[model samples]
Target: MAEWRDPQWEYFAIQSLRGKSFGDEWPTIPEFFQYTVERFPDNSAFTTFAGEQRESISYRELAQYVEALARSLQNLGLTAGDRVAVSGKNSPYWGIVYLAVLCAGCVVVPLDARQNGEFHKHLAEFTEAKAVFMDGDLLAKLEEAETEQPAYRKYLIQSRKDFADATGAKWETMWQMIESRKGDTTGALSSLAQIRSDDMAALLTTSGTTGNEKLAMLSHANFTSNLIQCVYPGLQEILSTDRLYLLLPMHHCYPMTAVFLEGISHGSELIFPRGLAVQQILQDLKDGKVTVFMGVPMLFNKIIQGVLNKVKAQPAAKQLMFRLMMGISGVSDRMGKAIGSKLFSGVLKAMGFDHIRILICGAGVLMPEVGEKYRRLGLNFIQGYGLTEAAPIVTLNPAGTSEVRSVGRLLPMITGRLESSPELSAPVVSVRGHEVGELCIDGPNKMSGYYKNPQATAEAFTEDGFLRTGDMGYFDRNGYFYITGRSKNVIVTAGGKNIYPEEIEELFQLCSWFEQVMVRGYREDGTEKTELVVYPKLSEDCVARIAADRDAFLSGDTVKDPAKQEEIIGVQLHREILADVQRISRKLPDYQRIGRVRVILLSLEMTTTQKIKRFLAESRFAQHNDGLLTESQDF
Candidate 1:
């Protein structure tokens, strides 16, 4: 099959060992899992914090546990076509339970643990789940939901010590059930009989980049195709002995597919972090000897800032030497990987990333400058583009062939198109250089539909069946995709020109003072105007210096001088920030230019993947309109 296909997909049955097949006869997820278990039975499959102790489970052991749990669920009178929901943070037990549910031929629903109680209840009821396996802390919400929506027959609690009291009478500890079964694999083969390749395997909720969220009904074939078509080709160079560090929540499709599932399929050791604290992550990186590090842009930005801060604290001569070394590394990277990898080993090892061979970035747009910096530093950092709807991977930059600015080439067996709208009559998309448009995808990995919501499912696709990805992007001549922004987020000026806030924000990423930036339009006299809100992360030493100077002045000491006042320091900092904003604003158009800028002292609320909740901040700006800069009402 060609990489790109027509709008009306031609489906064919795929061949497989299990006698089950999808379009063109492809093997399903269970078949793939069977293959992996047989291939790497003795390898360590997963590791995570169990209570205060770190627990490691081998592939063979994990397979046995999954089978036993499947048997237990079957014995409880749960049928093959039932819905089971799993809500929690990433853990080895979560992985085992997820696979076990699928092995029993039930559709798995992985909910975002961070969602509000109302949204969580709505989704559980929407999916019509028969059973739920949740982190014990969230049991109360489910119990409340059962009162209004009584479909669920059981609730299984994850045994975290703090949440023991939250469990209900219907609850059973996941690990306890598996332990009692004692590796019984009696009905494992028979359970596989009930599963079909095209049946819904998992229901992953969309990130809700727009207003509301919907569940994508992905099949065993959908996920398995993604594993083979997207993940395998990108990881061709990565070895089975490599260790992949899993930091983000595993329920997220990016980490679930790229890090967790890929590691299991490739026989790599997956090391789960105890938490997201930088200090803890650093220790885990050193202790686990993690060879593959994957994360979102925000986490990488923090790590880079931390490294630079440490470098700045060193003496003048050391700083000069480091800069010279970085220059050499940049030159080597421009030359190619063979030269760069060998030349930058010393610097990379000093930064504690020596063992890391690949760094996969996803979730949100990774700044090009950051990608370039890591490339020069000898870590093969590459961007991956996908969503939960496509089993989360459609494209990944191949090592050695990657470009800094682009998000890499499309993966095998995937087809993409761009349109002005979701309608079939919508114009064919084009771009000036790397300009973007609404990105659409069609492939074997594409989802079946939004689960149980026919209206939403119908709205999510074009008449010709292309998945309408609310994301806007354009592809270069080299087939490298560059995401500009979301269609809903584009700021339109009075002149009718569209501007992406992310483009403007990317320009400010290199600025040292600004910690976070969000650009939006404010309404004035029924007209829209652009504004920028910035959260400045001041240097700790600078804050201390200002505090000391203020304290000394207030003490009425004769030694205190007005020239060294805290107010003076504040004025100087403000001037520097104004200059930086002006420099960036020059690149933007007149209407799109920032009119109001505010420097916030506190960090903004962010998602688990580190994307700022724009709607929350937008509402805050409206509530405190007095703090913002505004033009005259006449304008």
Candidate 2:
């Protein structure tokens, strides 16, 4: 096995002497959960928004539930090392099922429930899941799935509704199975306790940004090592007393490792949103006394917009006070910890982040402007970079002393180096600071391989056994990593200059009118030419002005005027957006400029985390080709 080294581990070891350690070996999810239970049995584990009706399960109670579930699973004739799949939204039940399967000595396969039929079929078949636990909406698809998927043995429904027909396939509702085995099953618990740390715990799938998604095989040690890495580093700041507000989908590796597993390990209370609504999230943050806020760039953007809008509407004196306080806070944040002195605490409290000590942005690149604003507002906004394959954490900005543009220093026990790629001659292979290349990693957090796909597993690693991240980035002199773009997404112009759509898109994010943007090279004749497609979320004021102008024109109020009263406001807004794009592109080479742009009136399709689906947008742009702005055509 390749050895992995991350420098942060030693720092964590020195600071967090009292916390539990899994040693150099990784523990299975069940083992970690058990360890936490043994250490903090009385601490509150999870909470939800249905009334103040909190489900305060102590570590001991959580362990018993896991044992009970494991016993029930065992009674169903599931042997050790079998694959059990679970698909659903984030909930306490989801967490319980994940750990129970591990305790039962079975490999857990977590599937994203929002996936389409093709993705669902691919994932289920890829893992060879023996049994599947799914929600009601997904159960219908499972019925059809069994005909195509012969390896699946059972379908356990998570909802209350009964299966309309279950003649051919074996099906059981979650509640029914648990109720039937309500009596204590201590013997099964003893059987579970015999499992080892090296046992396989999960088969987490990659995001498949470049091609088809592959299942990354992870043992108990992989996840356990990652959990310890996060907890031990900032034990003093990130403690059990802090309330973690979890809004990101728990199925993804980043949130799974950073928020869910970390919270469970530390015995901190986790507050789930009532739903995905932004208003609900704001209300939850305030009411739940949330101390830790972990979210994606889109979520943070929306929250910032909400706060800014409020600031804009305030009285002149209040606005002046807020701006002055923000400036003071910014200086403090830059000059190290002692400067701000909580001068803007009242402003932050009003904006619903009073108790929030750490606001972590992961899953994608966060705009620096947003990061700076949060810092100025007295929030500890930090960015982390990793993939699903790395047990999801390779680099994270430490709570304090984080550089604005850097993704913090390299994590402990992880060795990173940039060298020339033997496969690709042009682009370099990134190792250490500032030189861009394909980011490669070899670490404990790295996945074993793609499950059941030896060909893909072999392709994932380089000749030297480093995991090819497919992401392009470089380390700065200070060891903070700055990602440029994906290697595959780089646009090579006719002039041979490389352009990254993400860099151009980041510029558009500064435009308040636009919500999302995707810049890509499309075929113009036989040559590839670049085009910009922007999804603008027009402000209410803009919308109303357009509506009023239309109303006036329709009423013939301006008929007598020879001036073309065409809704020039919309056109003017588009021009302003184009100008902003041009201003940012001045920093880039000529080939990467905004040669053409398409201002979308409707919102662009996006994932749950608010990442614009590039292919989808490309397809939509192609369908409306005539309306698009292009260099060949006049603006």
For candidate 2, what's the RMSD?
A: 6.3
Error of 2 at 558 (Å): 26
In terms of lDDT, model 2 sits at 0.69
- TM-score for candidate 1, please give it: 0.85
In candidate 1, what are the lDDT values of residues 1-635, reduced to their tens digit? 76433222212212433353232355556555666677788888887654456667787887888887777777777777788888887777788788888888888888888876666677768888887788766776667655464677555545434234553545677766666675567534324547777888888877754435678888887876776665433333445788889889876788887787767766788898878888678767766778989898878887887878888999999889877877887876777634556666765666668788888888888789888778777778888888888888877888755487777777777778877843211233334745456888898888988876899889778899988777788888778888877777777665556767877787777677787887877666676667777766667875565456544422324223333332433556655666788887877657668876655444456666777778777665565432223232121
lDDT, each prediction:
0.71, 0.69
Off by over 4 Å in 2: 1-24, 51-55, 117-122, 144-171, 185-194, 232-237, 338-341, 421-433, 523-529, 538-576, 586-591, 601-605, 615-627, 630-635
lDDT per residue as tens, model 2, 344-456: 67767776788888888877887788888888877777888888888888788878654667766566677787544333325543334346777888877888788788998
TM-score of 2: 0.84
Error of 1 at 147 (Å): 4.8
